[model samples]
Target: MRVSGEKLDDQQIIEKIMRSLSARFDYNVVAIEERNDIFTLTFEGLMSSLCSHEQQMNKRINSTKLEQALQSKASIGGHGG
Candidate 1:
């Protein structure tokens, strides 16, 4: 996402990515490449960190789907499907 209608710099983009990954995660920005307005960030981190992030994301997605399903069910009728 752009800020104030201006494109983010390489460092800004890297910092944003790092924020999502969290500083606690054992990772380092190895390299960055820009092509066709797309910035690619290369990082090296512990396998455990990757796995942990994946698990957390999966849980969030599943929980969101379940919540939506429950809401939809309630809106229609509280009965077994």
Candidate 2:
């Protein structure tokens, strides 16, 4: 993930990014590099998991879409209605 801010300092930006990521995913900061005002953060999933960040993000998106679909169906007299 890349996080950059014009007003916030590097530490502040890192903290905010970490908080946002921790809220949704289980990960550890594997590496951090800064160049040209951009902060590049590399994360590794916990428990020696093999899933990449892109895969995890895709799963979260798909799960959210499924939940929304289920809710819409239920609201319209479908399953669980």
Candidate 3:
């Protein structure tokens, strides 16, 4: 998914988002690419953060990834891909 930002290329933005999602949810984000400003997520990833939810059984299994896909650049690093 894409967040509102400027200058960052699609790949860079996607990389930052994927890292945050992996960290925040503790999920193993296997792969992340980009298409325009939108993103497609693959499922079956794990997230420890969701364990505390009252409704332990999340109907949407992929929500953890969706939740992790935030709309902000926490940070950017390096010029090399």
Compare the candidates by lDDT and give the number of the best one.
1
Worst 10 residues of 2 by lDDT: 41-50
Tell me which residue pairs clash in candidate 3.
none
Tens-digit lDDT track of model 2 for 1-81: 245435765565555655556533533443322232224332232222324665878898999999999888788876444
Query: How big is the positional error of residue 30 in model 1, measured in Å on the Cα after superposition?
Result: 11
Model 2 steric clash pairs: none
Q: What are the lDDT scores of the predictions, listed in order?
A: 0.56, 0.52, 0.40
How does each model score on TM-score?
0.42, 0.37, 0.28
User: For candidate 2, what is the TM-score?
Assistant: 0.37
Better of 1 and 3 by TM-score: 1
lDDT of 1: 0.56
lDDT of 1 by residue, 3-73 (tens): 66879766575566655665534333232222322244333333344566668877999999999999998
The reply for model 1, stretches above 4 Å from the true place, is: 1-45, 78-81
Model 3 misplacement above 4 A: 1-6, 22-28, 31-57, 60-81
Tens-place lDDT per residue, model 3, 1-81, is 335545775455545655666353433344223232224322222123234431443535467656555422222223333
Q: Please give the clash total of every predicted structure, in order.
A: 0, 0, 0
Model 3 is weakest, by summed lDDT over 10 consecutive residues, at: 41-50
